[model samples]
Target: MVFDERLVMAFILENAIKYGGKARSKSVLGKILSVKPEYRNAIKDLIEYIKSKIEYVNSLSQDELLKLYEEYKDYVKTPTKAEKKSPLPPLPNAEIGKVVTRFAPNPDFVLHLGSLRPLIISYEYAKIYEGRFIVRFEDTDPRTKKPKLEYYKLILDDIRWLGIEPDEVYYQSDRLELYYNVARELIGRGYAYVCLCPSEEFSKLSKSGVACPHRGQSPSENMELFDKMLSGEFKEGEAVLRIKTDLSHPNPSVRDWPALRIIDTKRYPHPRVGVKYRVWPLYNFSCAIDDYYMGVTHVFRGVEHKVNEEKQRYIYKYLDWKEPTYIHHGRLAIPGGILSKSKILKGIREGLYKSVDDPKLATVPALRRRGFRPEALKNIILRVGISPSNAVIDFSLLASENRKIVDRLANRYFGVRNPFKVYFKRVSHIDLIKIRKHPDYPERGVRRFEFRDEYISLYIDFEDYSNIISRDPFRLIGIGNFILEEADKQVKIRYIDNDVKKAKKEGYKFIHWVPVDHSIKCIFIYPDTTYEGYSELNILDEKVDSVIQFERIGYFRIEDLGRNNINVVFAHD
Candidate 1:
């Protein structure tokens, strides 16, 4: 049986482009040689053939490689259609149009990948049911975890970038009066009481299931005490309002959970409202009150809040209000990623991180700076769904998803890292090399390059030079085939032919090159380091923010660092 080399080359190229120019030999062998019964007998020959052509296969530019894929993707294994991310399973007892969801974030810091899980989940659930989505800020604490006014707007912008515009927005700082009224109602109904016990005494009583003496006060007395507590009469830590849950409950923390406390605003004034009020509601009290009044039919929160959910149930029970449907998904974390706000803040303060957008962090600003698309984030969240299983995400998964989105549009350019000079010895006329701006998008027009003459010296990477075997012919990408005469401190090549088919037939390796005279200095910022390289001068004309593939290297976002030095942020390979 005669084997069609075209079909085999196409399969090799497809796998190469998918895996960033380097397709494993075992992977390609298993797909073609092992899978098909008729081809199994030729496995040994196929292995040798692959060994000879692997270097040439890996060096094909994105456009040239994908062009082969488009022609022969149907032969080996049909490329699977991308799976559509289904909507989340319906909320229990949730009515179609009546379902309401909320993403309440503390505005102390910028949103990170961990925070985006709830945002995407809640926003998508609301979108699925055609219901209202609420964006609320829980910023009542003026002391520790104090809200920064700047992050409030930054959070909104991040939400917008994620393709969500909240139907209703609320800030806890602006709803203090409402929270105070709700606390008064709880006191008036005797479902809550003023606790005047010292911190140590309350801790012992709560642990021993013994109520404090103040827990037995009459509703009238409690209301007066609360009134005094709300006024400037009570000093900080002198009094606190506690919801009256079963004191005998197994979880001691659930016994009489603190609802409201007096803060010494004179010492820690709020960023927004300043010292306008002294009484501040803790998380559960204010959140429970708002969920009831704001008509939040469903609440999506991290599973770590299961205890808080237990405490908030009492508030709903006391008010005789229906508690919002609670969906507690497991926390999403990136292993080895900086997700803690305190650590990130500390790093910033210590100058370890230039800003929140430092490429090392997983914060929203950092991801954006690192060229992560919002679509990639949305796809990841939707794929994970609301499963209770804790997800420790791998950054490579995100990079792969991002590559799928960017590969379709990112233009290909010639760039060489650790460049070395290569001079072609044969004389010939100048050649006009027309390269596509985007491989798949030909209508984008071709990027023209003028090769002065056949006796041209071009800049190629030392890595590529080291890989080439001396005396063997290889194709110089879009230019022509050449034999490496010398490969030492300086590479010397003699022109062979301009036929790509002859090079492929001979299993000659292919490499990328840039005209030495038409190249620019480039700085590529990676997640952990930066690379300085030389790229074809055509890259200089690309607009800032343009995401382009650096030939066989990776995709990078162009940034105008000014002064003729092009800076790019590496997205992925």
Candidate 2:
């Protein structure tokens, strides 16, 4: 078959530019044969021509490579879109400018993968309609689910990292007077009553669908009791203002559910308000009041809160307010990841985890530190959408998604773990090796290494050394082919010709190596294990939090750059 030289050169240049200015002869040959199977009969002759083209392409400078690529890139098949579709379905009853959404977190702990679903859905929906997105901190329960001062900022940072900026931010602790006035209005209207009954008696009476004696108090008397309770007369558990629901309600917890309860601020002082207030609101009351006041037109939460939705609606009914649109999605579970706040806290206390951002946990901070991209996470959430069915997210799915994003962006470098030093003997003079920083992006430039001695030393992974020890000649990646001469504590090899076609024809296995004198110390951390290794010295040019591929290793994000070593967390293969 007569091949188009221009098209073949385009393929060669594109491949070479993608892989550090060095294209493989076999890859170009395969591309030609695939498009024109008639060339298969003359594969031997085609490969020789392909090798000649590759040699010319590799010799070109970065600028020349790019200039030729522009002329011939059209010959290379450009990727075509399958279809244009939105990641999330349109929200029901979502008007263009009238829609509003909220993500109300308790601020008792950092957000996990489960909590991220509602947050992303709400924020994206608000963006879709050009409406307001509110971030309300439901932090009223200072005794049980106490809000820490640090977590408020941490949660906001997490949201910002996810590319969401709230139109309005609210903290329930700062609006105690508003909740007090609402509670007083409910009591005066006889929609709620202050109950001073003991817990055991209330439980027995409410369980049997019977009202306690205190439930029958007059509105005036109940109002006075509530005022006294707020003034610290009622100690914790001695007084709880209950929303008057049906006595025969099927869900017993919904019957006269406690709305506002007295807590002794002297014992469990709130991190925000300290001992300034004695009365605190419950989840249902604070959420209901804020949602109405903040003008939240829609509520996006998990299906587990269906019962809470039912309970909060009574407040809207009593106050004669419009109910917001409620969209409760399914629970999101990461099969092996620890998403439970209590368990994570326990692990932290027991020293099993370093902190909330421990690489092992599935918390947003942990995921960020472990090299997961925010865009990958946002895409995952959008694909799940508002499905009501319980969803389980396998971590492998996330890894797969992340790989696609980092592959083209992350620059490649050599890293060796369990390194076994190998010396190249019989080198007569100094040699300079130039490898492209990225095969696909030549503009990023190249990484150069200067070998200044007759005997050059490099570190190869011990595992790779064991695998290739029996082979007569193996390719040292961008360097050249080498024949193993001695396999002992001090391993050695003799250099062969740097002929690309010869290496390919002889079926040489390529392996990554780092110069022993020109590399930096690296601590490679994974979820379950950690390895000490050496990476190319140019890795120092990368900033912390930058993700880069370790050639034959995997992608990793720079976590910390120490005085002598750099720390990186493994993202994916």
**Highest-scoring model, TM-score:** 2
Q: Over the full model, what C-alpha lDDT does candidate 1 score relative to the true structure?
A: 0.82
Instruction: Give a tens-digit lDDT track for model 2, residues 280-375.
Output: 999889999999988888898876787898899899999999988777677899977999999999999999999998888999999999888899
Candidate 1 lDDT tens digits, 274-325: 9998999999999999999999988888878889999999988888899887
Worst 10 residues of 1 by lDDT: 78-87
The number of residue pairs in model 2 that clash at the backbone is 5
Give me candidate 2's TM-score against the actual structure.
Answer: 0.84
Instruction: Please report, as a residue range, the 10-residue window in candidate 2 with the lowest summed lDDT.
Output: 78-87
| Per-candidate TM-score against the hidden true structure | 0.81, 0.84
